[model samples]
Target chain A: MDFSSKLLEQAVLEMSQLPGIGKRTALRLVLHLLKQPEMQTLQLTDALSNLRTQIKLCKNCHNISDTDLCEICANPTRVKEIVCVVEDIRDVMAIENTGQYRGLYHVLGGKISPMDGIGPSQLKIKSLIDKVREGEIEEIIFALSSTLEGDTTNFYIFKQLEGLEIKTSTIARGISVGDELEYADEVTLGRSIANRVPFESSLKS
Target chain B: MDFSSKLLEQAVLEMSQLPGIGKRTALRLVLHLLKQPEMQTLQLTDALSNLRTQIKLCKNCHNISDTDLCEICANPTRVKEIVCVVEDIRDVMAIENTGQYRGLYHVLGGKISPMDGIGPSQLKIKSLIDKVREGEIEEIIFALSSTLEGDTTNFYIFKQLEGLEIKTSTIARGISVGDELEYADEVTLGRSIANRVPFESSLKS
Candidate 1:
């Protein structure tokens, strides 16, 4: 299309590469950004750039962070003896929003999907086991989704933690299912977290 | 709801300020951007900043450009005698995409509307009239949306050019209404442009 100078087209092309953004929407966004003050666009661009450059996986919990340890892990008030494990940073944000849980978080990065060639080793599972093996973590609450992959990942973690004195439990799956932690409103997610079931208790006294 | 990390929340707030973006979509977008490299975010931020600071509205057509005269206005081959008047830069893009027209353009900035307190005086209408008085222009095509406001603006321009011994016309109404030109596909818009009619040709002797 005969558009104004090539810069407009360049901005649109870059935006269109983002997930869920189509060409039309991208163009509209570029135009809208053009209408904004230069500072706002610069801030957004810097944030996106920092998301990749300044960020690295937290060695403790595997969450994206500006430092070796995520802000959640670096905080002093957070519970150090209990780590809530989840599939991604979005999940961490969902749990954090509730303000009901005070423990630190472990971002698994993603679930184990055999078809996608993902398995226990591909994720931060080894680091998770190491964290638990250090013996300070008294309880581990699993907040993964209830999809088949979620269950598989959970059980794998459960098996890996076997015979360890540390208590292990999976966050209740009653309110959430499939790849939907992103959509589970706070109340439902909180309820599930409160009702977490101990893996050892399920086997009997 | 009590959210952690004010920066992430701020990002969502700013994204939702866009014309069509909503809260959930903005959240998804922020998170997606977070997953990208810092360089990408920086580029977007830089582009946005540059979009406002470095870019200026072209002095002639009012199409956005980095210079006083946009690339379109500065180009020599485009026929200066035929001025295709459009409502905004988006229309300029639409006409350019077809690669059919070889005329210079005049972006009216917006159509006239008294209800919004925008009138012929508020727009670049004076500039348009000045062009007509110069006596070199043979045809002025109103490639604006066909609507009450568009037609109203067209009539206002037609009246301004009264007895100038020049041709004044409007883009066809077969495919446009109420500023819906932004949503129209290229083919329909192109056809409408090709089938335009003179404003008062039917009334003239």
Candidate 2:
């Protein structure tokens, strides 16, 4: 297709920047948007503009929010004594969808990665430490990924929480929910129960 | 994740309205947008908004343009005598990309879909007829799809061009390039060449 119109070309350029989307796909999407009613297309444009302009980081947890406090932080029913420390809000949502954790969230923003110029200072680690130091939290759960950076971040946090009696734990990794015990692959099933913990004393010395 | 943030929710909602995009994909895209640089995301938003604000249809050919006449229409090298009639600008672009034609184009805006309440009045058929009546055109090629509505629209245009000596033809569909010619099915290849004729005979009788 002729990429003539600057706005059309720009839309394609912007869309191509997205993962897995190329210039051709972006062009198709732009053309598709052109055919749609004005409101729908304008809404998408407004939504994109607002995604950056309107959304702010929650002061308490750093989860995306419009105000200083995210809904999770402002909620009274959520258990504040049990803090779930996650590398990102995505992890927080992943845990929350289980309907299992009623605890408050602590968004680290990112895992500590020294090689990539990302350190604890880059993340919201100081804020998390300050939240924990208030002494109201009873448990601090680590819900970082199984990556190397996740391990290092966990250790760093544990070191920082040195003098605290708060219970430290992590979510299990092997197998998954609704797994068939009989049909389970040997390594997967064996590792699932093997790595299973009591959720209280696990990840502790 | 809970789609609670107004901007995030709006982004998701807008994404969901796109063709082939569902709620899950919308959420994924919105979340992906969040990971991109703030400036990059804003560029896309601005581009989309600019498309509506800045882009306009060419008054002559009805093709999408940033000005009164599209670049294709303004290009002196393009053969105005061989005007390719398409259902939309997308069709015009597809032909342009083929690099096989050096002709001007006329966008019909849309096809006649009575079921969807689209009729001759909804399309740019009147504009096309008026342009053809000027008698400068030698060949008026039909580059619409072979779909039911596309054929219907083509037939309608063919009738309008009746007694006007301008030849009307269509883009030939064949086994794609790079496809194994030796392994090629003779029937499809034969049909391809047979269907392709000089612009005159296809429309005349």
Candidate 3:
């Protein structure tokens, strides 16, 4: 679209570079900023700039952090022996919100997606293997999504830990809580039935 | 939802302030930016900052511009005597894209909406009246959306120019082009019938 001002055009172009935002949406967003107080724009730009320049990753788990270590990795209450392997920090946040598990996390940054040119080396798989080799973690939980890429990454790491003396398991897949049984997908329903847990164990949770 | 890093939280908060963006979408956008090269974030922030700090408004029509006088106003070919009054710069761009209008534009910045605490004084209405009083413009066209606010704003300006010798007209409102007549709304279809032009006039366009 033709823009009267080069500044507006540049801003829209940069905004549209973001995932899911198209040129029309970018224009609307930039125009919204233009209409708001100048302080709003200043605050937004400052926050983004600070995040890019000053944000740090946890030295232990590679999760986004303000310091050298993330809060979860640094907390003494969190279980260091049982590490949960996941795709990224968003998944970590999701599990943390559930408040069901206390295990520390090892953020893989992303799954092994060959279609997207993301191999095992592009992820944090090496660091995880190194941590396991050091004998720090006992139980490893594969909490990644149940997609093909997720399974590939999980299997790759599982193969690497073949000789290690650590227990490995994947998160249970089933119909979501509060969802109707009929609405569950075929693969998930089949898995849920095949890997059925004991009735008493379900009551315990 | 809880964020792992304060910088991430701040960036998400500022991003969510944009219209139609919620916390979830903000987090997704921020995470996408984090995964991209740091230079992407820098460029986005820089462009937004530059636009906010350096963008100027046209001295003639109050449209966003990089110069005192906008390209449309500066152009000798555009008709200075016929001015299309619109809500904002987006409308100006939309009208310009038609390639039919060779007239100058007068951006009102926004319509007078009492519900939003917006008054005529907050808009560029006074300057438009002053221009009409100066006898430079011969015809004033109201090309604003057919909303209550748009109509109110148009009437308010029409009253202000009541005694002026300039001709006042509103853009024709009807069913959109290529829209099925059966699906057209009652008001628009009625307006189209009530304000029907000659068949030869329609054929000419």
Candidate 4:
């Protein structure tokens, strides 16, 4: 770890500060950058700095955006009345990739995890509640993970919307498309059986 | 892979360009950075850009440095006559970490790899030969890796120094200190047997 230059050491230290990168990996990455043209390093640095300083969050849904409104929230074709709620931007991207749903999104930023000190106040729950209270949203879909924290967040929000004139539902749980029936968890298998669709309706997809 | 914003996409693309980082990992890293304070990203970007643009190579040893001469070559206590020739700065650091060698170093930048179109001219070999021709170097130790490329580079340099007055040697190859003999590779085990050292010399360390 004895670097030849202070600049190299500083670079490695900063790089290793990233979540999963260690000092050795940081050193390797920095050395790789050193081997490339200066333009590559400049480009990388510029992108990172620009992202940190100039990136904006959507006012409506709390998703990262280049403007006040995100693409999904701004799109006229997307259903404004049907909002799918999820944790973080990755889920939004995942749902967007499916091309199956045309609804808007409300990113919670994170679920309610008391172990991690995150609660409703730390998320975008208030803004979502405000949007629903404005009486425009007709249905709210809970598309969060099936973890304990996810359920806790969903229940917390559901309690807040007790008298609101909106329908709320969770995404369906079942065995994955290619999974064997025997391998499916008991809870999922039971739910899949209870929520079984009519034989003709299953042919729509 | 449809990004919500152009800036996010650009940052992820640049990050994924790094070795061992894929698009998914790049997205994760970028998102982690986004969640942190802007100052952290600015510091990292500054360090990277500075390291790439301002770093220098030592004139004497061709190792990375902040000045004209590297620390090892600049030190008056290090033996100037005895030089350990290595493939790159990493080897120099590795040998320095051992705390056994007190000699100067000559970094070749890279080995002579014909398959990769790398030749002596592409490396610091000519400067090494020039140093030997200067008649100041008394001994040159080859500390390159145990690969075919390493051997080809060593042999090529050895041929050039055939008529020189300097003594030439290579680092000893044997079983690693903590490794079991039964698990040792055949080539290394055979060489260890063929070049067995005196029992008293083995006990010196």
Error of 2 at B105 (Å): 0.6
Q: Which residue ranges in model 3 land beyond 4 Å of their true spot?
A: none
Ranking by lDDT, best first? Answer: 3, 4, 2, 1
lDDT of 2 by residue, A75-106 (tens): 99999899888877667777778788888888
Model 1: residues >4 Å from true position, as ranges?
A46-59, A64-78, A114-122, A175-205, B1-3, B113-122, B175-205
Give the winner by TM-score: 1 or 4: 4
For model 4 the local lDDT of residue A90 reads 95
TM-score of each: 0.76, 0.84, 0.97, 0.97
Candidate 3, residue B124: lDDT: 96
Question: Higher DockQ: candidate 3 or 4?
Answer: 4
Question: On a 0 to 100 scale, what is the lDDT of residue B30 in model 3?
Answer: 92
Q: After superposition, how far is residue B103 of candidate 4 from its true place, in Å?
A: 0.7
Alpha-carbon deviation at A32 in model 4, angstroms: 0.5
Residues B1-205, candidate 4: write the lDDT tens digits. Answer: 9999999999999999999999999999999999998999999999999989889999999999988898888999999999899987779889989999999999998899989899999999999999999998999999999899999999999999988999999999999999999999999999999999999998988
Cα lDDT for residue A203, candidate 2: 48
lDDT of 4 by residue, A157-192 (tens): 999999999999999998788999998999999999
Superposed model 2: Cα runs more than 4 Å off: A112-117, A182-187, A195-205, B35-37, B113-117, B182-187, B193-205
Q: Judged by DockQ cut-offs, is candidate 1 incorrect, acceptable, medium or high?
A: acceptable
